[model samples]
Target: MFCFHRLGLRAAAALIVGLGIATSARAEFPDRPIQFVSPYAAGGANDFLTRLMAQHMGDELKTTIVVDNRAGANGVVGASFVAKAQPDGYTVLMGNSATHGTNPTLYPDVTYDPVKDFAPIGMVGSVPIVLAVNAKLNVRTVAELIAYGKANPSKLSYGSSGIGGTGHLAGEAFNAAAGLDMVHVPYKGDAPAAADAMGGQVSMAFVGVASAASMLQSGKIRILAVASPKRSSSLPDVPTLEEAGFKGLYFAQWYALFTRAGTPAATIEKLNGALKLALARSDVKKAMASQGADAAYTTPAALNTFYRSEVKRFGEIIHRLNIKATN
Candidate 1:
């Protein structure tokens, strides 16, 4: 009888200890506020999303969350910083396609592995790319742009945000799919490239929907076609590239949340839960939609699959087009 009593006591103690461990893990998961890093310029689409997401995430997590813009080096410096950070679920990188999928193939020594260095939390959103041309150029439709490019050959120059940007890849996809010979011009960023395109410095450019929304509305630039899988609700009148006969040329600025690798699974899941809830808010949905951004909060496993597929997708395109950074 004493042995059984002792066994019962030991079991109860083990149960109590397990409960304490679980409670401690949950408590330490986020002992303090969190920081979300935006590796893009302030006022940019990605930066705006980061700030808004931070606010909403803070509300969800019941902790202060802030955005720190570390905009430079095509998101490499900031991404590298996050990659080397402690996997403590405190510092998260609001990374985009540039730093995650496209840079690995574009920059040989980018200082971090896109797949291995970080643990995926969730995919935030993606900004669709649109083919916009100077309003006065008299090119309003995709057919007209294709015709003009074919007839003028190297005379029609297309600008991109930068080398290896989604806009750049969109332009290359256009040329590949339509067999057009347009001169490719690389710009410093989306705003500058769209500026030149609006000013008629270039005949056309693959512009991010957010970057070109104002110009398109003001008649500064005419959108030829959208490169997204579906027509943007903000620009429902515009047709998709595939609908315009340029199939297999989809491109967009995909954004996702990630933390340094080796973060505890519970910690990662906690962050993901907060983000998921935050992104589902109506205001968050509306803000993202206004910028032509999709409110897609993908699971870590789903994000990993999508990231790998995009890497492969762009890799094939790069290899086929001989796209090398000629610095």
Candidate 2:
């Protein structure tokens, strides 16, 4: 195992003491306005979740929680901002697996070290993506879709959120495991990708729950299979990809809270509390449920462990796929 030098240990202790001082310095954590940054478009799923959590967190922290949209470079822009921000408690990042886990493998020159540069605050929850078919496809289950793809081969195409986003990786992972080659059609975002699927421009898509939930409910698109280990609570009737024949083929994207690596420990603890409480609220749970999202919570340590595993897993996949990072 690797070990830290003497000076490094002292620095860690000072950081902890500093956090304690910061806590005592203020009556509470949110004595000032808090800024939460989302590394995606203003209206995407990441932005939506950050907004929802901020509203509830505002109530608990007894201060305004401002959400800033810094969309670009597949969430790299906002994440880089957060990585370089002051280690103080005021600035926080809602980091997804795309930036934290997969980017390292995809980008040959990763800007931020996922496990080193940021402190793991807490996990928001998990979102299971679905393999959805347009109403025109006439394919409804995973079995039928596989058979049709095999017969037609490259004739069928599917859309993804972006080239290296979690939604995109899910589709690629499916294709790799199933040994089938379907033309991959990339889009700017999940909304547009879902739009193409609904418009019959694409035969099917592997998209996040947020973009496809309403369409699925209204019968706009037929869900072939949910890419999760278990059936989603919101769509329990929909079989998992494993149940549909591709056993152990599960892909879900989740978000975690973070701050610069040198952030105050007390502030981190305070933020973790707020996250747990916000996720517990009936309103957040209901909102997530409507979006086919589950309200799961985890402690800071657990979140860190999870983050490490995800980083390792996605690192392997991205390297194999030869995805090159832009920045």
Candidate 3:
């Protein structure tokens, strides 16, 4: 009995030591530089926001984060790269509504499964899209714009950063809900899209508040409605689509972070904790506000649920409107 008791004690000690080593390994995670992938080109809103988040998140993690831009196919290139990378905590994706929510539904050949291949970390923020027309247009309100589009049919044209983007879907939703026949004009990015709208190359475009702020201030465009459920703090005077009499017409581009799906749960917890801390920083919030982005954070579980629902909602809109990706 004495020998047996000693043997049991030794085995228990070994097990405890093993567990301690495992815990230590997790605690020491991210000892090296982390690779943050943004699947879009540099200088766009997505890239800018991703870089900003990475800076603060890196500071919290006490490690360097290198942003790798792999632009192509509307975020598919970077997303696929991260999806196939080792399921370690070092490789992550800065994905948005397009990469995770709409691109999968819009592209029949999408390589990565947004939910199946990635473990959501948390949401960074959301930019409310605004519907604005060239000041040259005679319409003054959302109702008037709809009436004009209905009366003019193809005579009304709207530009978007790209097809199957939040802006594109918002335009299509408007067309269906208000019984309008506005044509969609796709541009390389929001800058060109807004520029064309101001130049009268298109009647209007659904653009993010940050990208459209200059034109809104310069009186080059007249914002008819914001695509958020409520008025944005950035545009205090602007009303939501619901407030504009189009209840249930809502759209916003949300940005979130993710890692390969098989990353250890403990690592995810650590990353999520760091993310919450970074988002809570006042400077981060101010920087986001400057870009018309609200610093909205969510737990990993909450983000997963929200991501799934957004995928479904965006997919339904794509099908309902028969929207297609032009590029």
Candidate 4:
């Protein structure tokens, strides 16, 4: 009995030691380089912002953060990769409006749940979508465009990045709100859509600020109104759709950081803190401005709540429009 008691005591001590080691390991959180996955092609807004944020976050965390581009299937490829990654803080995804907000409704075979499959770190910022027309479309303001469309049914056609994209939804929403009958012209991508719009192939288009920067600068297209609630600093002269006498057309492009579900709360807080620090830097703000994006950040809880609302909002739009993803 004495020997058994001694052995039991030893086992308890070993168990305590093991628990201590596990706690320490959890506390060590980002002891090694982190892999930041950008679920889009290189040179796009998502990739650009991810690289910049990774650099700044790496600086704050005092560790290396490598950006891995996993572009395909309209962001599902990279999103799935991150969804299946370990719950450790080492692997994270740069989630945007499509991945966490609308993909579930758009794609019938989405592999992960936006709210359940990952832990939201925090929001990076919002990229505003612009409603632009060809330079020589002969329409100056939203009112004029509406009047023209009303007079000529199906004469006013708008282009989008692709079918069922945010741009398409925005155009449809705009048509419904303005009481106009405008046709939607889907292109393969933003470049071609905006290009055709600039060349007068289409009457107008809903374009991301980042993708429309050059077009705005080169006088290729004339912006009618911004789709966001507030006007973008990049185009201070441009008015929001509300300011242009059309309300409830507030569509935002949300970008944020996220990790797989089951990540430790402490680790999520640490990453959120690092992201806040990086977003507050002057250089980071400048980069965002150059890309026609705003520097915005939110707490983890706030992000989770906002993400859910976005998913619901966009999901409704997708359902009502009957938009389906091809891939």
Judged by TM-score, which candidate is best? 3
Which regions of candidate 2 fall more than 4 Å away from where they truly are? 1-28, 217-220, 324-327
In candidate 3 the C-alpha lDDT for residue 20 amounts to: 97
lDDT of 2 by residue, 96-178 (tens): 88878777777656678877889888998778988888887688777777788899888888898878777777887888787
Name model 1 segments beyond 4 Å from true: 1-26
Poorest lDDT segment (10 consecutive residues) of candidate 4: 318-327
Q: What local lDDT does model 1 show for residue 175?
A: 82
In the order shown, what is each candidate's alpha-carbon RMSD? 4.1, 9.5, 4.0, 3.6
Residue pairs clashing, model 1: none
Q: Tens digit of lDDT per residue, candidate 1, span 82-144?
A: 999999989999998888878888888889998889999999998899888988778778888
Q: What TM-score number comes out for model 1?
A: 0.89
lDDT, each prediction: 0.87, 0.82, 0.89, 0.86
Model 4, range 1-327, lDDT digits (tens) per residue? 999999999999999999999998766778899999999989877888999999999998999999999988778889999999999888999998889988888887888888889999999988788898988868889998888888888788899887666788888888888988888888866777888888889988887776666676778789888998888888889899999888878776668999999999988998999999999999899988877779889999999999899889999988886666652
Residue 67 lDDT (model 1)? 86
Candidate 4 stretches greater than 4 Å from native: 1-27
TM-score of each: 0.89, 0.87, 0.91, 0.90
